[model samples]
Target: MKAFNDFADRVRKEKREHYSKPVSYCLNYILVYIYEPITLNQLANMVNLHPNYLSTLFKKEIGVSFSEYVQKAKKLMKRNNS
Candidate 1:
């Protein structure tokens, strides 16, 4: 029973890590390249996901549309710089 429980925990952790890779990469990329023009297609291609699916997934994971997040990030950066 303990072995089975441990296996289940590991499986759950792996699943979370797998699904988060794209979102995580996207978060880092946007922050690092905040000033660069970023497009869904470009990020989707980099993450090897379909653009439409990535758009949906990104929104689901990040709690905002990609463009909205980028705009917010830009605003925050500008305010910090000023």
Candidate 2:
């Protein structure tokens, strides 16, 4: 169990680094939007940020709003399903 826990911790750390490296709020938002299925307000709460501020940051970094990002992700999911 200890070894399994260690392995899980390592995997989590690597995943966090993979997401944090590029540090694009939009990408993070998109990923969370697709995989997590939470509201914008909930996501903002998770990150301890204001929803409007997060929205602006996402736009600045990704050149699109969170809604657009989620739409693109959903489209990709649909394409993959076929």
Candidate 3:
């Protein structure tokens, strides 16, 4: 599928950043919910973290703003017809 290829290409191109301790949990959460209807504020509340802090940490590790990542994911999902 084109969407899967896009996902694979992104995975191959973008090097993941390192995080530690409890914050790493957010990384896993982000990965699982990439294409879901979620926002930084929602995720911040879910993870019990401050919005600003979450945004900073997310961008630092993920190498993109949260909204940007979500947009790309949504595009991919649409491409895949999922």
Candidate 4:
């Protein structure tokens, strides 16, 4: 029974991690095109998330505002010559 409980816990953790990856990837994808001079509403529609929800998730996971994250990602990409 203890082993079964441990397995369940591990699976739950893995599932959460898997779900989080796509959210992070989506943020990165959005950041990549953020410089194209589009409105926030348009980007939100493209990503299929509510603008408010996307803002909250971006802040929680990336430790910054969405705009800030885009700046940081652009800086890092430039540093890496990407």
TM for every model, in the order presented, reads: 0.76, 0.59, 0.60, 0.54
Query: Which of candidates 1 and 2 is the stronger one according to TM-score?
Result: 1
The lDDT of model 2 is 0.69
lDDT of 2 by residue, 1-82 (tens): 9999999999988765453222255466556557567566776776777898877766665567877878888889779888
Model 4 / residue 57 / CA error / Å: 1.6
Q: Which candidate has the highest lDDT of all?
A: 1
Candidate 4 residues lying further than 4 Å off, grouped into runs, are 1-22, 31-39
Q: What C-alpha RMSD separates each model from the true structure?
A: 5.3, 9.1, 8.5, 5.2
* Ten residues in sequence with the least summed lDDT for candidate 4: 16-25
Q: Give one digit per residue, the lDDT tens place, for model 1 in 1-82.
A: 9999999999988876664889899999999999999988999999999999999998887779999999999999999999
Better model by TM-score: candidate 3 vs candidate 4? 3
Model 1 sits at a Cα RMSD from the real structure of 5.3
lDDT of 4 by residue, 25-79 (tens): 6665665675565444565776788888877776776567777766776778678
Clashing pairs in 2: none
Pairs clashing within candidate 4: none
lDDT of 4 at 33: 71
By summed lDDT, the worst window of 10 consecutive residues in model 3 runs over: 14-23
Error of 2 at 45 (Å): 0.4
Clashes of each: 0, 0, 0, 0
